[model samples]
Every structure is written in structure tokens, then in C-alpha cells.
Target: MNDKKSVLRSSFLINFAIGLLIFFAFTIGLTTKVYIGGGIELYGTFLLALLILALNSPYVKHLSILSKNQALVLILIAWVLINNAELGRGIYERLMFTLFFFLVYLFISEYNEWTGFCLNSIKVLGIVYAMLTVFFALNTGLYVNIVMPVFADYTSIYQQNYAFLNGYLCGFTPNAAINAIYILAALGVCFSNVIVSNRRKVTSWILPFFLLGILFMTGKRGHLIFCLIALVLVYFINSSEDIINKYSKFVLITFGLVIVFIIAVQYIPALANVFTKFENQTEMGRIDSGRFDIWNYAFGSFLKSPLWGHGWDSFKYLFEPVYGYQINVHNVYIQLLTDVGLLGAIPFYCFFIMSFKHVKKAFKFYKNSTDLKAKRDICFALYIQVFFLLYCLTGNPLYDATPLFLYIISCAIGEYYYSTRNKT
Candidate 1:
């Protein structure tokens, strides 16, 4: 009945709600199969709404520090509306996910302490996933060792791949390529901020090793390229005492290349066997099918509804009558344009542009910020944002919940840091 008691009660509820969200997220991730048929709606959307309500309690008046990130929010709203209009649905229907996203955005932005907790939680999740891999290895006799677990619903493709590169290891996430890209993004963040390289050599070594593990497990070409880009940027930005640039970036990269060369030379027999399997053509056939059927059809459909998209989740339906292929475009940009038309895409572009601008400004502040910790955090945010921008070009950024969460958190953190700086 007391105000203090009420606030405490609200806090407990909020924490419980968030824990549930995280749990379901983990469950859905591990299950790897579509629960479909309203299962997602009941468990996912309802709990999300409850979580939002708990956070919006009057007891927690100044919930998020999102005032600083208002520009991004505005841009995103504008884009969603314009895009949805093109699809003949209002913004509300087309961008339903944005509704829940803003709630999450607010919770993280308004609550300062939760940010630290969330960061630590990610590391915890990584460790839990590592354990799951061991469990999978033990339960199933598929692989020689228990390094990663196979999802109950996932195909065999995930367990068969193991080729490391650039210090990334992808142990979980059913779609290895997508999982690798996500890990690489996580690595960029952890490397930039979580670990203080100067304070501990072990932290530095662990960061790269985990990254290597992720890259090897995923076997995704796009992720490999992105990791290389991240390495160059992280090295150059962090290398303060060295030459104008970090030659270590070049040298390390060359070393990786040389290692690949030597491995190729020494294991030509094994490599030949792998290459022989590669020649089977099924993989290329599937890719070619996607390129012609999904990609091309989506492009043509986008032109028809250039102003607004056909509808949210409506592209496959719209295309089925024409292309006879029931499939997602597998490209975020195209997905956006098809689902919400040109009007929507403009706002989407604005949201992205503004988010990057804020990140850039934060990076510039590093030069003037006297606080070493603040400088490091800002630069770290910049690296994470860079990873998002680069990864979206090749993959549908919002297809997975992780990327959406990453973008929202980045904006939230950037907003708080910038606002606090201006206040002083």
C-alpha cells in the first residue's frame, strides 16, 4: 500500500517479465522450429505486452533515457508509416513488431542499471549455449566430440560444418551462417568494450578465440568478410600508440591467410575430399533457385508497388500467384520495400541514417571526452553499429530477434551517453 512498497513491487514485476521474455527467446532459439499456428502470438506477443505494461508503471516515471534518441525513433516511425501505406495497410498493421520494439527500447533506455545487467547477460547466454553444445554432443552420437548441440528441429547441415577463420567459433544458432554473423557482431561489441585489453591478456586472447570459433562453425562467406572489416577498423581505432595505423591488422590478416595457405597445402588430401563433395552442386543449385525465384520475383513485385509495399508478410502470398514459389526474399532491404513501398523505405533509410549519425557523433565525442571509460564505451557502440550496417546488406537484418535487439540497445546507449554529456 505504501508508495515505496508499490515501486518495489513494480520493479519485481518488471524483472520477472523481462526474465520470461529472455527465457522464451532462448527456448524459441534452441527449438529452431516454427511453433506456428498462434503459438507465437500467445506466448511471444502477450508476454511482450505484459512486459511493456510493467515497465510503464507510474512508479518508474523516468523509465528510459530515450529523449536523447528521439531522432531515431521519429525517423523509424515515419518510415514504418510510409512503407505500410504503400502496402495498403496502415503503419500499425505493417510494423506490428515495432510496437513491441519500442517497449523494449524504452525499458532499456529508461533504465540505466539494466544496461550493464544486459551486457553481462549476453556473456551468460554465450556460456549457456556453449554448455548446450556439450550436451548435444553427449546426447547425440552424430559428432566425435561435444562442442555444439544440434537443435531438436534443425537439419543435419549445422552439425557437419567446422572450419575456423579469424578467431570466431559458432557453436549454436541453427542457421550457422546467420549465427556466425550474429556472433561476429557480438564479438565486435565485446572486444571493443567488455574486455579491457590493457588490463588483462587473457581477456584479449579469449575474445579472438571465441570469434574464431564462431567463424569456423558458421562457414559463411559474408561473415568472414565482415569480420575482416571489423578487424581492420577495431585495430586502427584502438591502436593509439603505434604508427598512424595498426600494422598488426595487416600482419594478423596476412598470418590468417598464410595459415589458410599452409593448411591447404598440408591437408590437400582432406581438402580434395571436401572439394569433391562441394562439386555435388546441390548447394549451388539451391542458391541459384533462390536467386532466380525469390530474389528476382521480389524485385519485380517491388516495382509494382513502388510507392508502398504489397503488405507485411504478404510478399510470399502476392508472389505465389505469379512465381509459384512460396518463400521469403531472404534480403532485408527487398523485404522492406516489398512489404512497405517507397514511402516506407524512405523513413527506414532515415531511421538508419539517424542512428548512424548519433553513433558517429558519439565517436567524435571520444576525442573530447576526458573520461577514459566513456570514450571506450562510445567507440564500442560505433563498432557495433558498423557491424549492423554491414551485415544488413547481405542478410535480412530484422529477420532474427537478436539483430533487432542489438540495434535498439545501441540507440538506447548512444542516446543516454550523448544526453548526459550535454547535461554537464
Candidate 2:
């Protein structure tokens, strides 16, 4: 009776955890006034309750107190040093956000291993959001001009007739481009696993169509280029034993078929005008123009505060806007250079490089492990983390909630795998 009850409790907790994670992933990035009248503290209130529970749990205490996260501790110290020095406002802004995200990771890992639920939830939410956004974007284009007033400068009262017909669309964050990238990264990791074979095959069939939908809907060149890069990397570097290797030829063939289908659709004269927009680069102007100017500004600021940084996230206000008001650098490497100087950033660089090397080794070590479950879990954790690191280059995934959850999962998995080896 006790054994059955224990199993039931575990199953319930896992299911509940998954539900909460899904809710967070789909809603965190949204700016909708879901919590009206400054009720945002509701989210905070729930988090505080979780924190209290975590503090009381011995398992949480053990996992949270790992030496592996020392690299992140250095990051916080660096932030304080720069902030105390009053070097530049940019450094201060960057540190504040980085520290906030860092704490989130620590808290989650310390609480328990939350990676499986968090990642699976993210994958599910991403697909749902992408489809919903596409559906609405198409309908909006048909009925009205789809005048995006929020981004008046970037988006005019343009007719989107072609957008409706082609099935490419998005919402406030734009047509699921970012979400697509996230899903692609998840798919890479999921497919790499030796387990989950049936689910992997289903995703393989669905994702190419999803990718095609994303490409057509958003008209975003960046994601298309990113997809191509990922494809090439997986093709050249993935081992035959890796899940991607098994499906590589099939994936490539599917992509070719998608291209042919797109061309066939373009035979319609109405769609020709829409496809022509692919050659246009007007939307990317702000990003391109700011690239050189931001670098020039960051370089001068960096020289003055070589040791620390201008202050986290303070790039624009403190540095004198070369182009416009400071926001985010949009590039992690550049952002790190300006936010945390070489003294601080080097530890992070070392941590990632070492972690990847370690994970790759762990995946190989799986073959020799006596315990099959432990071996598979270790491989799953390591490969998933690798996928996130690769995706981080394009977007600073580490700066947000989902990214923090992933790191926590990675740390917990690493600790469990290595400790078991030690015991044996």
C-alpha cells in the first residue's frame, strides 16, 4: 500500500509541475494586460510560495548547493564590482538583468530537477503559439489592412493580401520567428535521444512543415539563414549514432520538397508580387545601420572602463546614443564585452566551453555505463543543453526564464550522473 501511494504522489507532482511550466512558457513573453491594474505581483506571490517550499526540502537544499555553479557566482561578483566602481551606466543595466536571470536558474536547480517538464512544456507551447499567431495573422490580413500601430515606424498600413494566401503570419512579437528557432533547437535535442523514437519520428514529419509555415509567414530572412546554418552544422558534425544523423537524409529531402511546393504555389501571379518581397531588405535597416554605430560606441566606453564595464544594460544612456536610445546589444558576445569586461566574461566563456566538452564526453560514456536509465538520462540532459548553447548565439536565451530553467536542469543532471559514477 505504501509503495503504491508513493508512486501516485510522484506521478501527481510530475503532472502538476508540467502544467505549471507550460503556463509560464506561453505567458512569460507576452505583454498583454492579462494581469490588469498592476496585478503582476500575483506571479511574484506564487514564486515566493515555491521558494518557501524549496527552502524546506532537503533534496532542494542538496541540489542547490553545488560547486559547479561557481562560474555563475563570478558573474554576480563582477556585476557588483562594476556597479560599485560607477564606471558606466550600460554596465549597470546589463548586470542587473543578468543577475536576475542567474538567480532564477539557481533557484530552480536548487529546488529540484525541473528540466524535463520545463523543456517539454516549452516545445508544446511554442508550437501552439506559432499556429495560433499564423491563423490570426492570415485572417487579419484578409479583413483589414493589418495596420500594426505599435510599430508604426517599422510597419505601415500596408496591404497583406499575399500574407493571408501564403499562410505566413504572427502577432505582437511578430510571426513566430523566435518561437520557430526555439522549437528547432528543441527538435535537434529531442531527435538526438535514443529513447522517444516514435515521438521523434512524428516531430520529424511535422516540423519541416512548421518550418515552411514560419518562413512564409514572417518573411524574416534571419530565421531562414539560421535554419540553413543549423542544417549544415547537423549534417557535417553530427555522429552517425546521433539521432540527427539517422534522419539527416530524410530531413534534407523534405526540405527540398518544401521548396518545390513553395515554387508551385508561386505560379499564381498574385503570389509573385508577395514572393518578390523576399528580395527587399528595408526591415533590416535599423539593425544593420545600428551595428557599426553601436560597436563604435561600445568600444570607446569599454576602453574607459576596461576592468568592469559601463554598468550592466546601461549602454545607451551612459554611452551617448550613437544611433538611438540604448536597449539591448542583440548579440551575446558584444553584449558580454560591454556589460562584463574580459575579467568577468572569461569565466563564463570557460564554463560554457568546459561544460560542452564535459557533456560530449558524458554522452560517449553512456555506452559503458551499467545502468541504462542513468546513461540515457545523462545523454538526454547533455545533448539538450548543447542545443540551447548553439541556439543562444542568435538570441540571448540565457537572459530569460526558459533559459534559466534549462541551466538548472543541466546542473542537476550533471551532478546526478557524476555522483552516481563516483559511488560505483
Candidate 3:
């Protein structure tokens, strides 16, 4: 048993290290010139997960967290083939990525030793990613013109789209909104790390603030709003602490942070510009910026084939003329309802239901957990879950591979730690 655990540990750490290199390789580039649509770092991350599972081939038990997901791939196939739907190569490829990431998450979840480690990794990665994002947002003009040659192609596109606000901060990412999806995901992880920690540090609190600051500059309205919601939820989550410490203190801290940033906006042009855009859009009564039109279109389309979606990314052919190159429904639930239909979305829905059940249990256990590591991991997993659920209200995270994997990884982490709490 000892030897087996050691080998599993070795495999996980080795792959995690490789994952870090891939993260920087693609992320630091002026543009992910190397990241085709799927995001190369995501490939490295999920492929490394497969490597870990491959190395730990002899399993004693199945990952219960995956039981509902067992039917997702099958449901997808039958939904597409049965409808005689045109499953384009791109959608099919992304679906395959979804399947692989889901399976990899399932297989590796049983090895619970790494949950704590991953929480730490997410914290550090979130901070570093946030710093890079903030710097890029503030210096978009400098970088686009002088530093990163690869972003030249998208220079006109970015400038035109962001003419209202500070430039799209996620200039280096595959998609600004998609980048915001997982960055918000990471923000949840780090947010919980600080809120639930037994030993809080200055950096722990500062990290999420920095991440939130950069997210504002990105001008991703959905991500920015939902991320704040997730943070407030984290602060007030029932913990084995006095009401003042857990709730009152957090409320005060959050209030203070908001006050500080509000004052900072008065002085910081970049931050001030974000609010100016929001005000300008609101005054025009176009706060949604066309998302409502897209959602209405996708929802009505889903009604045409309510049982299963029109087929994966069915909107691509129909959407370009209507929405101008935007392929997603910008809402995952609606996307599922549109892509596979209600019948096909059963498994996908079940997967979230199952994960939510675990998260619900994790929150219950968190209130009483004396084990600090378990508490932190459990909270880390919980907020990541919250981030995804809320983010799905206005974003198409599932349509992108990296955010999809990050979302599922949170489910796995939640399930693993929740089960451990039950066992104890």
C-alpha cells in the first residue's frame, strides 16, 4: 500500500510540473500563437491527467464522481447520429475533448492525496496569471504595438471591440471571455483558500483582490459579476467559527475592499474606464450588449428540438450571419439544450446535479471540519463549483476546453474531499 501510494504521488507531481511548463509556454506568449482553438495548455493538462491515470492502471475502485458522466459520451453520439444532424469536425473534436477531460477527471479522482496540492497550485497560478493580466490590461497599447508581434493579426479586432473601454485585458489568451471563465474559476479557488484558511496571510487576502482587479479591466461583465457573487458566498459559508469571524468579519472586509477599489477607481484611469463603459452601456439601455438577443435566438432554437439539442454547435452555420462569427450560445445550459436537446442533455445535467450534491455536502461538512486541509480543499472545490454555476448564467465555458476541464476538475476535487469527510 505504501509503495503504491508513493508511485501514484510520483506520477501526479511529475505531470503537474509538466503542466506548469505548458501553462507558461502558451500563456506568456504575446498571443497564444501556438494555441489553436483548443488551448495547448489544456491539452497538456488533460493529457498529463491521462498519464497519471495510465501510470496508476490497477484500480481497486471506480470513481463514484464519474458514475453519472458514464453516459455522457454515449448520449452525445446517439443524439447526433439519431438526429442525422451535421456534426461538424470542430464540434466533434471539442466534444471528444470534453469526453477525455471528463474521463481523466473520473480516473484520477480516487487518488485524493493531490487535492490539497492542487489547491495550492491554483492559488499560486491564479496570482501569477492575475498579475500578468493586470499588467497587460494597463499596457495594452505598448504590448500590441511594440512587444508581442503575434497579436498583430487581432490588433484591429481588439481595438475595434474595446474602443469603449480599456483594451481587452486578456490579449494573450485564446478568447477574452473564455480566459475570464477559468481565471474566475481560479479566483474562486484562491478566494476559498483565504476565507477558509486556519492560518491567513497578507498574500492570501491580496491574491483574490488582485485577480478581481484584473478581471474588471478585462470588461467581461458576466465573469466580473458572478465572480463577486462567488466571493460573497465564500465569505459567508457556514464554518466552525463564531458568527463575527465567519460572517461579520467577512462582510466588513468585503465592504472595505469595495470601498477601497471605489476610491482607487477615482484615481486609476484603467479601473475608471471599466466603470465608465458599464455606465455608458447602461445609459444606452444595452447593458447586455446583444447577449439577450443571442440567448433568445438559442433558446427558441432549442425549442425546435426540445428533446435533444439541434446538435453540438448547431449554431455555427446559422449564427455567423446573425451574430457575426460567434459560435456559442454564450450560455452552457442553453447550449446543451440547443446542442443535444433535452433528452441528450440528461447526462450532462446529471453530472452537474451530482457535483452539486457533493458540493452541498462539502459545505455542510466544512462547517464542522476540524481538519484544516480538508476544510480548505473542500471550500476551494465549493467556490470553483459556485463560479461555474453562476458563470454559466452568461458565459459559454463548456464550449471551451480549458474552462471545461477546470470546471470538471473542481467537481472531482469536491467529490473526493466530500467523500473523505463522510468516511471520517
Lowest lDDT 10-residue stretch of candidate 1: 161-170
lDDT of 2 by residue, 247-275 (tens): 68668876897687678666523223224
Model 1 has an lDDT value of: 0.55
* lDDT tens digits by residue: candidate 3, 265-322: 8876566545766887899999887778888888888888788566666766657787
C-alpha lDDT of residue 282 in model 2: 46
* Best prediction by TM-score: 3
Q: Which ten residues in a row have the lowest lDDT in candidate 3?
A: 57-66
Candidates' lDDT values, in order? 0.55, 0.50, 0.64
Q: What is the lDDT of residue 30 in candidate 2?
A: 41
What lDDT would candidate 2 get against the real structure?
Answer: 0.50
lDDT of 3: 0.64
